[model samples]
Target: MHDATVIGNRLRTLRKWRGLTLVELAGMAGMSKTHLSDIERGLKALDRRSYVASLSTALRVSEADLVGGPHLTQDPVQAGPHSTVPQMRIALQTNTLTEPATDRAREVGILTAEVKQLEDVFARCDYVTLGSRLPGIIDELHFHAARPQNEAAQRDSLTALVEACMYATFRMKDLGYGDLAHQAATRAEEAARLLGDPVALGKAAYCRIQTMPREAGWDRKLTAARRAADTLQPHVRSAEGTAVLGMLILTSALAAAVAYRLDDARDGLAEARDLANYIDDDPCRNWSAFSITNVGAWGVALAVESGESGGAVLEKARIVDESLLLGRPSRRATFLADVGRGLAREQKTAKGALGWMLRAEGVAPQRIRNSPQVREAVAVMIQRSKVAASGRELRGLAARMGIPH
Candidate 1:
């Protein structure tokens, strides 16, 4: 077994290297900041089964590697030093990083190279092509979390990964791989506890709970989503964290709205709107689309689901239609779902609902092979679609996908 002091110190070092404050990292890890402080300081020992496994997922270290080794503190950038491979071997006792890749693993390896290259540009720079890569970027995060150089790198990657997971999960619904997406989101939440940033924690927690409703854990989904909502504060303390709050608002509120909790959904949207305003006024940054586009889309979605206001839905539709024209499959799926929800709210003939819902159904298969978010949202509407009280062929289409009523 690895020495407890060494493990703790390695964890602490990784956390620090990622630039996460103790409170942030602890919060991301789901441990109290004080307790994390004790562990890092050597006053307490890690509980291997529960704490260590989660820590491993969050840290990307193996059970064996976590116990003994020189431990990789190297940056997770794919270009890890070739020369250090030997030193990495000497210290690690068991060299996990140098392991060769399998066929599937090799694909993921290339994906990681591309993702890191893009993410570096995402973090330190800007480019017109960035939006084009968002989908692949999220996919890579799922793959990378399983192979981080250390807990800190995992923590560092958690925020972006969660953003991708939540975005895909909500709008897509059927991400085809529900289990993988759920695990990815769960790991992101585990890492959020280490981030110690309450705002980040709130965001990660939101994604963690969202997979619950559709994955046979509705009870946990409802409970955890509510809990995560409770954790987001109404302050713009950290510009980035606050911007992320907008994402939390949009995703968590959408979950609440879908769960049929009108009160929670409404309250969550109100807070989210306020956060959006704050995020808008701050200096422009990469998350501008996050705060503006997604925030607006989510608010409209919550309103359509929980409110009877046709004007509100129409208004939101107008805005989303104007700003969202990239044909990004996830965004298209999200917008189409909201439009269907709006028509459903108006009691417009099922035709209106059918029109948009069909477009969404078509969009889902075309954009992604497995999207749970779109499936769930579409399924809900399919439940509501009365075939617009007409269209025989359309009803057939709707029936096949499981529309209710």
Candidate 2:
């Protein structure tokens, strides 16, 4: 699949056609200019999946273009679906970059409403609608942050920018656009630094962890998670503080599971449980709804990730009421996907596993489509469905999800 010389030549051709110098392209791609130049000159290989993805996103091309597909003569933004990159570009093109000095109150109120709208859109899993609106929201935040006002105004503007960038990171990662997500994470981190708010910084760190490429190594992810938890733990008495703490700890448990440190994973989850207990079931932080049940949901995912199976995983999942999970459809969907995984991996309850996977898709089709573990379960369940009547429904669900029959 790797043709290094061909890939390098395509990279050069695309860069020239787009009128981007190596430095500009490298900045957009989150790589060094020298490294980008080396790849274009065929002195280095473009063999890594992450690098190729970032290069394609930077050049406003597709992975297919970099990997020997036909050249894309149209605007790159026109190539993808309603993803964040295209939308952000549109936002930049349309919105005024300079903010007027006199309408500070009006602008702040507008931003507050927009932030709530964005958060509600995410909560409802209305991704397409959210994508459509994000460009304008992001553009407005940028304009607000670009101008200097009072400390309160600047902090509010920067926090809004951080939130918008974080949303972009989360949405892009959920859609499997790791490279694009990385750019958003960088913006979130930069904005968080500008705000100088500990909570925003911690949230930005969480976004960085969420957007991290899988090849970055699970151990590195675990380290980042621990650092975020440590940084945010000092403010654990407040609800938002506890929510951020819980988020970091939840991420740590998952990262530890992926790193194969089962004990560390459990310890992280235990801390998450404590933080969750501090919250009052409300969505404490913008998108992070930290609650005891949410911690239990993570426990379900961790158990599956750690290769726990059979009744062990099922019993653990049972401890958290399904109703508690229902408030956040995305989290509930993920939990059910893990249930499917645990069952399928153990090979003890094929029919039940298929049912759980189907239920997850019913709750959130995008979550299942984006989840590698859930897809694997579907693949295994497809094989099992070959013999049983219950398998017919699984087959139908797989077909609806575009799984090959």
**Which candidate number would show the highest TM-score if scored against the true structure?**
2
Query: Which parts of model 1 have CA positions greater than 4 angstroms off?
Result: 1-113, 116-173, 193-200, 213-223, 229-239, 255-261, 281-289, 307-316, 319-321, 325-328, 344-348, 358-405
Question: What's the CA RMSD for each of the models?
Answer: 18.9, 10.8
Instruction: Report clashes for each candidate as comma-separated counts.
Output: 39, 0
Q: Best candidate, lDDT-wise? A: 2
lDDT of prediction 1: 0.49
- Across residues 165-209, which tens digit of lDDT does each residue of candidate 2 receive? 777777666665676677778777878887777888888999999
lDDT of each: 0.49, 0.69
TM-score for each predicted model, relative to the true structure: 0.49, 0.75
Candidate 1 at residue 217, lDDT?
29
lDDT of 1 by residue, 1-405 (tens): 113233456678767666789887766666788867765654344522334444555555554444342212222221122222332123122211223222122243455455545543333212223334544455445444556667665554555555544443332223133343455455456545645668767766765665552323233455665566556655447666666666655665665665566677777777766766665532224342465555666666666645434456767677654335333444555566666656543444335655676666565433321222222333334434455454564545434433232
**Ten residues in sequence with the least summed lDDT for candidate 1:** 70-79
- lDDT, model 1, position 279: 53
